[model samples]
Target chain A: MDNENRIIITVLGKDKVGIIAGVTAVLAEANANILDISQTVLQEFLTMILVVDLSECKIEFDELCERLNEAGKKIGVQINAQHESVFKYMHRI
Target chain B: MPITIHPDEILETIRMVELENLDIRTITMGISLRDCADSDGKKIADKVYDKITTKARRLVSVGEEIQRELGLPIINKRISVTPVSLIGGLKSEEDFYQVAKSLDKAAKEVGVDFLGGFSALVHKGITPEEENLMAVIPGALADTERVCSSVNVASTKAGINMDAVLTMGKAIKEAARLTQDQDSIACAKLVVFCNVPEDNPFMAGAFHGVGEPDTVINIGVSGPGVVLNAVKKHPDVDFGTLAEIVKKTAFKITRMGELVGRVASRKLNVPFGIVDLSLAPTPAAGDSVAEILEAFGLERCGTHGTTAALALLNDAVKKGGSMASSYVGGLSGAFIPVSEDAGMIRAVEEGALTIEKLEAMTCVCSVGLDMIAVPGDTPEETIAAIIADEMAIGMINNKTTAVRIIPAWGKKAGDHVYFGGLLGSAPVMDLNKYGSKKFVSRGGRIPAPIQALTN
Candidate 1:
């Protein structure tokens, strides 16, 4: 219970430079460790999905999501951060 | 890297919630008030208030907690109690009014939007006290803000009570008159049912039946928008493919309701009831059930193939929702409440949908003729006849059906009545000018159909 802090972040918009660097900088600042990452570009639009562990985040979960969203806005992408359980429960079974 | 989750699924759910207005409509707690009955009406009302307040005191807080923790919106927290008519101690309209007030006060104290079960089950026969209670429904509803009332006047097993239907029509008109300044909003809070479910968690028809447990939790799922989104993805697909998509979408939405119901039940220490898989619509764009029908390529909702399309949609929803949860009950189909659906309002305005068309649609869908508005000059007999027709559909088909029509006072066909927020606005639809006074006045019973002979 003390260590399980999985979260999923998805970034979607037009593909551009430094999209990875921009998102990870805010995550690193929030002390969130990226565990899994997948990125694909389809017809000039970028879709980046990341699974991160936020057990040791420097900020609250809600605040971390807001900060990541703000960082994504700076790069002209839409970022959505959600607790991993939302996906696990919905997708797994 | 092991891909533990599919990005598409996650993104789809997030998109549905953030953009398409997907939500859990209501989490209702059913509390049996059978124990609150007393020889004295005042004492019974007091007991009813005490029991409901104590049992449901934490309902709103618990609902808010679940919403915040899951990051899923639960639109309402509500309570339903045992049918007031069955609590036989009350012998007069004043007693019924006292009980209605108690229910209203309890709802406000618990911070819920609505409370149901100011009801009477008169499908078979209307007792003296039940008749008296029926006489008071209009006053009761007019006196309380959040109190919802329902009457069961017909069922497959017991046939249609035309007498009670006539009474209900009169009562509805009275309620409309009582709230005429508010555009007959009180009539909007009253529902007439045939084969009403004991575990329905939706209003204005929910009530804790005698068979239900002392206290239980039930959830109603909301996702007309999510299903519409899925349908929009395959606009050109054949009907078979479209049905598959709706089934899959309904499966996912019902699962969310099941999870929320279980979690809410555990948190409140109440046994979990059923998840109602009704595609309830709101006035918001992209959230209308009619839009879902239109997604199937109908020029508008009330075209010739509307019933066929709705039948498929309703069946697919039940099939998918049943698989998602062991318990699926209530009115588990798409709801066609015109005032509550933006697409429907537009359809009616454009002459694509009508009260007659809606009545035909009800034979294949869930609730019947819901949230409709008729001209103020419409007679009580006409309303009773409409209710009778809807009830007959439910009885013969052996399905649940209800009518919640508001005869908007001083408003005629094409005129609009706005109730605002969730209840939304209504464009007074035209009713047949021809009268059904004689037909409705023949008030014995439309004897139970042959479908009830299965035993």
Candidate 2:
């Protein structure tokens, strides 16, 4: 996978129904493909990490982030989308 | 399957950024102004302005873009130029002031927070042009915003230049007096140095050296809060284990600096210079070097064993940071500025820290006696003596040291001078009443120490 086009999206907040649905809806609208997802609920809090492919996204990276953030806010969660390289560079070395 | 990164690692990174205040302190673009020199001071000023504006035009935007994309905070985007004194042919003090104005204008136009290198390297002796540049430093810094100045008055090889030291003392006093209404803020933008590093990305000490490339990008990483949290996590660990933990945390923080420097270098098409592995602290709560020291079981920073604790932390940070980056330059250790760290301020306020103790800590710390405020009535000769002491430390130990002391006009010990923001506020600490007039008045070079002969 092209590292530059891969983004790790983290959604964290209180556990609620449709949290994933709301977040994926924004990504779907932007044509972003969810490559992998691992989610868990511990102590009534939801922690979701998604590896998304933005190579085919139809919007700018910033716009995608904003849309995801807005969707997360509406769904009562906080979303952060960061380049995968930041993670790789910090952890792998 | 997508590249599998443990969820724990992802969460840890998030925690460092969100909860621990781990962030890149600065992305400084160093632009050499050797080519900007001209026989005419005005022409030189124009050339310097045009070059800086053109070179660093995209610095702030690129920094912002990277910040958003990485979801990390890059606190400052700054520029460092070659020392203005090196750009010869500027005769009068007014000519140097015009050049300083141009540098300030360029910094504003390019949107950088501060531009350094209105400096002179008089480690051994002062030149005619360099002297003129030093003379104008007070007025230049007071008249302009975002123009930082530094004067290197001593080095291990050339020993201490008492003449330059005394000159800088007067200049600092004048800078304070000129901006007294603003809490003597102009003095905060000036630094006096011994064994100064040319590629330091932090200000008010950063400057492009003659040996550097035409332009380059250097990164200064800051994560004292992150280190403090790591220390807090393992309260029962032994000293060896504690050092290991701090080193590991420093490695991770410096890795972020390396990545940011590489990304910004590629985006800006400038050569990657270095990643300064300094655990720079801010005035923000929980983000302090003193807090880290206190976490090491010290009752407070500047108490007994404080210097030893700082030595361990500073060494561990360097060890971890050097392994994480290809190039580690600048003052790559912990910065313990009084006003800039909340815990340091608290320590001073509670009488746990003193200027004398800070001077001792500087022997092991990265820089020396930074951002300390003294009484307004403190004599210039005393200031020169303090700087001389710091220079002597740097000379004998072969490390970089600096003095950024502010003698706040009309403010006495226990009074506060508030510059706000990153400059922070400092309580004026009492100084030794004894005068150094007799010692500093007999001014001459202190001569190279035995350590200087490395052959």
* TM-score of every model versus the real structure: 0.92, 0.99
Per-residue accuracy of model 1 over B108-164 as CA lDDT, tens digit each: 998999999999999988999998889988988988999999999999999999999
**Candidate that scores best on TM-score:** 2
- Which ten contiguous residues of candidate 1 chain B have the minimum total lDDT? B1-10
Candidate of highest DockQ: 2
**Each model's backbone clash number:** 0, 0
Candidate 1 residue spans exceeding 4 A from truth: A1-5, A11-34, A39-48, A52-81, B1-3, B452-455
lDDT by residue (tens digit), candidate 2, B98-144: 99999999999999999999999999999898989999999999999
Model 1 deviation from the true structure expressed as Cα RMSD, one decimal place: 2.9
Q: lDDT (0-100) at residue B334 of candidate 2?
A: 96
Local lDDT at B452 for model 2: 43
